[model samples]
Target: MFDRLRLMSDYEAPTPVWAPASVGAFVLSPTHLDHLGLDETLRTRLLRWQQYFDDHHPADLCGWDSPGSSQRYASEGEQLREELERALPGLRVELDLWPVPADD
Candidate 1:
C-alpha cells in the first residue's frame, strides 16, 4: 500500500485494537513516527485495512464493547485479524476505533 513511501525495517505499524471502546485502546501507535514518509506509509496500510473491514462487515458491529453485540459476526472479525497476521506477520491487528480514510 505504501510502496511509494520510503519504508524502514524498524518502522512499527500502528495497528488498531479494541479496548472496551469506553476506556478505549491505544488505537494508534504510541511511538512517534518522526519520518513523514513512514507515518504516511503506516496510515496507508491502516486505511487499506479500514476499507476492507467496512466492506466486509456490517456498520453496527462497532466492537465487543457494544451492548448485545458480542455475537455479531464475532468469528468473522477474528478471522480477519488472523488473516491479517498471516498476511502481515509481526504487525498485530490493533485497529479498532481508528477511522478509515474516505475514498477520495
Candidate 2:
C-alpha cells in the first residue's frame, strides 16, 4: 500500500487516483479472514486512512512551495502516528528523509 502511494507520488502524467477497494484485500487474505474478523472499528480506521491519502496528502503535496515542507510532513506524520495508535495499538510508523549531498 505504501509502495502504491509512493508510485502515485512519483507519477507525472495525469491519471485517475487509485484507492484500495477493501482494507481486507490489502491486509488480509481469505485464509486469514477467519483470524481477523471484519469489524466496524477496523473498517472505520481503514476508511479514515484511505481518505487521508486521497485528500489531505495530495492537497499538501501539490501545494507545497516553501521551505517549510518538512514541517507539513511532520504534522501529517504526527496525525498518522495518532491514528495508528488508536487503530493498531502498539504499532509504530516512522518517516525518514535523507538529504542528497549538494554535489549530487
**Highest TM-score against the true fold, candidate:** 2
Q: State the C-alpha lDDT per candidate.
A: 0.36, 0.35
Lowest lDDT 10-residue stretch of candidate 2: 2-11
The window of 10 residues in a row where model 1 has the poorest summed lDDT is 2-11
**Can you tell me which runs of candidate 1 are displaced by over 4 Å?**
1-26, 29-37, 60-104
List, residue by residue over 1-104, the lDDT tens digit for candidate 1.
Answer: 11111111111234333222344332334242233223455445544444444444335654233323333323334555555455444444432322222221
Measured by lDDT, the strongest candidate is 1
User: What would the per-residue lDDT of candidate 2 be over residues 23-75, giving only the tens digit for each residue?
Assistant: 32133332332233424554344344344444433554654344354344445
| TM-score to native of every candidate shown | 0.27, 0.31
Clashing pairs counted in every model: 5, 0
